[model samples]
Target: MAAPPLLHRHFSNSLSSPPLHRHFTSSLSFPSPSMRPAALEPNLFISPKPSLNLSKTFASVSFENQRRKPTSFAPASHASDSEPESRENRVGEAREAVAEYLQKYGASREEANCVSSNCPSYLSMLIDGVDDLDGWNSLAAAAENVEFKRKVSQMAEQKGDKGVLPFLESIGLSLASASRLARYFSPSKSNALPRLIHKIQARRGGLHLLGSENASFGYLIESFPRLLVLPLESCVKPIVLFLEVVGVPKECIRNIILLFPPVLTYDIDTDIKPRLRSFEKIGVKDTDLGKMLVKYPWILSASILENLEKILDFFDEEKVPRSCSSQAIKSWPHILGCSVSKMKLIVEELSKMDIKSKKLGHVIATSPQLLLRKPQELLQVVSFFKELGMDEDAIARTLGRCPEIFAANIDKTLDKKLEFLSNIGISKANIPRVVRKYPELFVCDVDRALLPRMRYLIEIGLSKKDVGFMVRRFSPLLGYSVDEVLRPKLEFLVKTMGRPVRDVVDYPRYFSYSLEKKIKPRYWVLKSRNIDFSLKEMLGKNDEEFADVYIGDGEVLVPPS
Candidate 1:
């Protein structure tokens, strides 16, 4: 009922500002080594701000456009007596300052440190005041999203003459991007593009659409420059209206166009509607049309639909069930974007590796993105596992169990996960067994997912050694959450069920049972009957088995109404 803590209030206020706009061209470079953020959401408890390096938190610009870094994007502080610290050194010092400051303001030390180290610029923004405090908070949010920062930073770093295509300049496209468009679209050695550009500007929906409220105009133009040349009435507007008629939400029109601007180039009767019909034929229910269009608007694109048919034909040839393929498309609509030629190569490679043809359909359904991966990348993942002493058959078994391992990147995905396992006390020797058993563990996030669960386990009373053994016994134990699954179940086990925490160590699978349905209902039945049961015995039973063992032997007593 009470208002949240000051840090939470401040974060909420700063995170709700106007989205980034054009005309914010400034260069910024930070030398901090990347560190992952500890908590997705900062702790809401109140605490004093840390005063470490109180000398320099507010040295950058105040919360405004052009944002946390100043207009010049210079170092946070300067020197009068001696040379200023190296850029890396300054980032390091600021990271320490922000991490400590965040901890004092209710973030756990892990959360603060991870955030501080990952992007010191974000932490620097907390102290560096931007100009327009009321409207520029999303700059802080941008610091958290690496992709958003890349886009914004790309716009901000544009260095061009002010005299470039004034029409696009007026509507937020960077001059560099506009110039590229002019050169690329104009094959003739003539000044006709500038004239064509102004003509499009004067057209009914051309410039107006680019400048429309809520359009991601810069990103759209950068991604698909041909939108600048496409006619407003004949090409673009009809498609926009067609989407609304087809049940894509009115609000989603801008996003659909931005994602697949070439949709404007497709013929409605020949290309667009036919693809929509193909989608319907494949069991994409009428109700899911809007959601699918928004997620992968290119599902209806001309080139993608061509590939979609090829992939679907390949599925039929491979003995894949029609129902499974249909569901796979429904779940991951972008699988339509994959090349069927590459898929054939992957199937051959998989066969040589002993991957079963029977399991391939289900793998395709579960890991649709795997079809998009290069064959060399799959080999790299296989080689990494082979180094772990797994034979090709064992590797195929692991893939059949969790195909996501093959879909993942070996260096970026698997190696980092292996490091996280090592950091958490998984021995180098036993990691292969754990990997084969719980291959999903490689897909888990090190900073956000795995570390937090392990830290909570230690916080609740499990020693590091106890957790290591527990995770080996039931590899999925780390996948359980501290707040949702682990904490509530542990409380019930110790306080309500009167069982030792050692029971969890002995039977880590106890976390897998649903608390409300299986665990609590069965435990209550046992309590009413005055019978003691081990966690494994209590949880590891089917309904009929459980009823026969306990309820069949004794009536579960009912309280008087």
Candidate 2:
């Protein structure tokens, strides 16, 4: 191919001066093709030295005379030479200047053409003696103008993918600009948490995009505490994913709120259970569930409980069940143990049900006391049992040896066993059995040890029949045979009044007799309606005294004292 046109010959000459000049001289038979005198003939080189000196002296005098002359003096004289430029003409000249300048910087004609057509005024100003740095700085000042950004983006697109970063950089876009563009292009989802999480995971510094006003995004960002003020939700998944992907320790995630959307009901028959089980597979614990429950109490809606019931039903329906209803029941205690309000709600709800809901009812019943106790106390009990590492059956058997602990003062006796319990690592649940089997151990007054056991019994809220059976079991430990302990008077008092013998034993003889007599009439009236008119009349006459003695609403009568 023939030699290419020397479009950037000046810069090329400066770059490859020595070799190119030599090549040009040898190939073209020219002393200096590029350096030839401007508009001079070949004969000028033939002049003698003295003639050349005289001509140079004359030329110098002429240049000095021209410099002294005023340009306005010749304005009308050289009408053809002076271009009459209007405002439009001036703008055209400016455009030409810019085009020439851009050409010198290696901008192709097509690229310059596109810029000129899109922003003629800007292009004109850009090339009017402005350096590359000044031109770009001016452009940057107008960067926020939608029209300017669009044109720049179009130019970059024309150059294809490789030009994107360079074009943006030339316009003063740093990493932050690229991110802003990305955000503008990809507006976050309605619930931006998942999208923000993905971005944070994909980009090392992506979390910085989260801002305080964008709380949803901020929540996710906060998941990475080292990165301040990120939305907790935005950071949550990434933190979770980081824990999963890189095996970060759970302790590192201490401050994050592990929120479960309130919409997620726990029905195993539905999608919720599988999702929960999946979370469990990834190391989420009952403790985690408990924490979520505590933090978002509203999540425990009726629907959630219904879903949990559905889960139980699913287990019941399965041939080889993955979960037992009983096991599911056991899990509820921890959830119910969250707060008094939650416990009360759970109990009230469960109490109204007549199905096979003992597990739920039991959990609800125990939860109030469990929550009321200090966490440290509960932890102590848990730790003690955990340290022993004995199986439940073994612990139950050991407890069977202590019956006196279950007697009238069962609540009082548990205090004495605390030391024993601590030494053996026995659990609190097992203490009741020990108290029932070995009542003698409960000989001590009600104290710390006894309180836990009493609380446990109260928590169970057993029916009268079950309570009687339990109380009778303590007979031998109380130094009485099982039959003697089951005497009619004791049984009647316990079953009917729900009071143990200890209360009657402590009462003064006169008071006890008075209460018994005062209560006897009402009890008889309730039992038999066939009592004569005369007896009814007498009972009515004593109604005020009966109210005073039994209901504490009126003055007691004293006649002929």
Candidate 3:
């Protein structure tokens, strides 16, 4: 037990403050009156009574008293009058005396032996000697020693009992020591180590054993998110082993942190292309495919999309397009079997479609497996639309415009048509009419024409689809095929004999001309005339003159005189 803190006492002559006076009074114990007024007080105090009697009394007693006690006090006075030793010299003598005593008996042979035996070198030697049978015996003796036990207990009390863990480990102690230290540090057996393991096991559904390498420990820390508080680098193996005992659940795992660089390899399946033709039947969505491209970005291969069609078909078969209930959506995961994140993204993309396709959303949300497959098929759909000259936005708008077409049966038909049209080269210009005239044709001729020129229209701030649609509508009035009417203009240079025509067949001029005269081909011509008269004749004989003429094509066209 610790002692109580000491209290300080203060004495002051002036007490103007009541609190100060009370504080002093409560703390101090003064002597009573009976103890006062001793003979020493007269010498100590310069009171009037003591001062007046001092000289008279001293003079009267001095001579006689001096004579009577002179011989008796001489030896004692002589001794007292001798020179006093310096404080430094006295201290030195004291030290010398203490040294002499210590040399003689302060430390006995037994005590010296004890100190020597416990010296670091001696202990190290003793430890070495205990190697084999002798070493075991010595270790046992140390373990059993009362003094050693007391020292260990004291060390534990000063520092936590956990301090013993490292010490025991350093000496290659047995599991018993580990257990003992653990118990001492955490008697309840609910320590961070065990708890971390439990948490990891609960989250990931697997245990990770620690490896001997430092990297192994790092892996353990990454794998077991809860064990972040430990000095992981020091004893990674133990930490890893502990993590291995505790399993991690799959659902709780969000992201994995890696210590080593990852290596990825891709294997292409040649058979996937034919399989992808049936993507819509399998429940794959263009949006889901688009998301996959965004997510992996690098894995956006045509082959992968083709393989994904099978998965999409599975989703399509199981999907309930009419149901918007949460239960229906929830049932998707059971049918499709995919992770939550994938399922969520798939559902979100599906929900953006018209309500008629709500069943697709429900199916995607419930089925993780379908969600996975949906991404590739989605990419394929987008590719198909793009090949037909439809941008992502255009495809989305078209899908949004016609929600009733996304039913499971209709979806398959649309997929087949898209494939057929894509193979045959249909233009996007014909899509709206085709879609409207033969909504049932979604199952047979889904492909639209590739209107690359429309992109230019869109770039100039016009909606590409709107431009294409308008061009298609006015094709007959324009007296040309929609492709020709919608064809973008090209720039070229033309050389002419005269001034350039600002406008071809100006309506105002043509109308006025028509009103005035019979219609006839109007021609403009430039003629040249040659004069026989020489320039010299104008300048007079002997003073020759020359003339020059230049044509537009950098050619000289002067007529000879």
Q: Please give the lDDT score at residue 439 for candidate 3.
A: 38
TM-score leader = 1
- Across 111-219, the per-residue lDDT of candidate 1 in tens digits comes to 4454344443332343233212212656646544433223322322232211123223333334344455434333231333233333333332353443353234444
The estimated TM-scores of all candidates read 0.61, 0.20, 0.18
Tens digit per residue, CA lDDT, model 2, 399-495: 2332122122212334444554444344555555544455354454434433443344344353333333433333222233223322433444457
Instruction: Please list the C-alpha lDDT of all candidates, in the order they appear.
Output: 0.59, 0.33, 0.30
lDDT of 3 by residue, 1-561 (tens): 000011111112211111111111221221223312232222221111111222221122222222122211111121344444532332233323322322232223332222222222222222222223223545556644433223323333333322223222222222232333332223222132223222222222222222121222222322222232222333333323222232322221111112200101111233322332333443445434333222222122333343233334433543544233223222331222233345445555555543124445444333323344444455455455566566555655544444334332325655665544444334655765455433334532222433343343344344434443443333221122224332211100012223122221111121122211111111111113222322122112111122222123433222222
* lDDT winner between candidates 1 and 3: 1
Which candidate, 1 or 2, has the higher lDDT? 1
| Candidate 3: C-alpha lDDT | 0.30
- Give me the runs in candidate 1 sitting further than 4 Å from their true place: 1-238, 244-252, 265-271, 525-533, 540-561
Ranking by lDDT: 1, 2, 3
- Give the range of the ten consecutive residues with the poorest summed lDDT in model 3: 1-10
Top model number, lDDT:
1
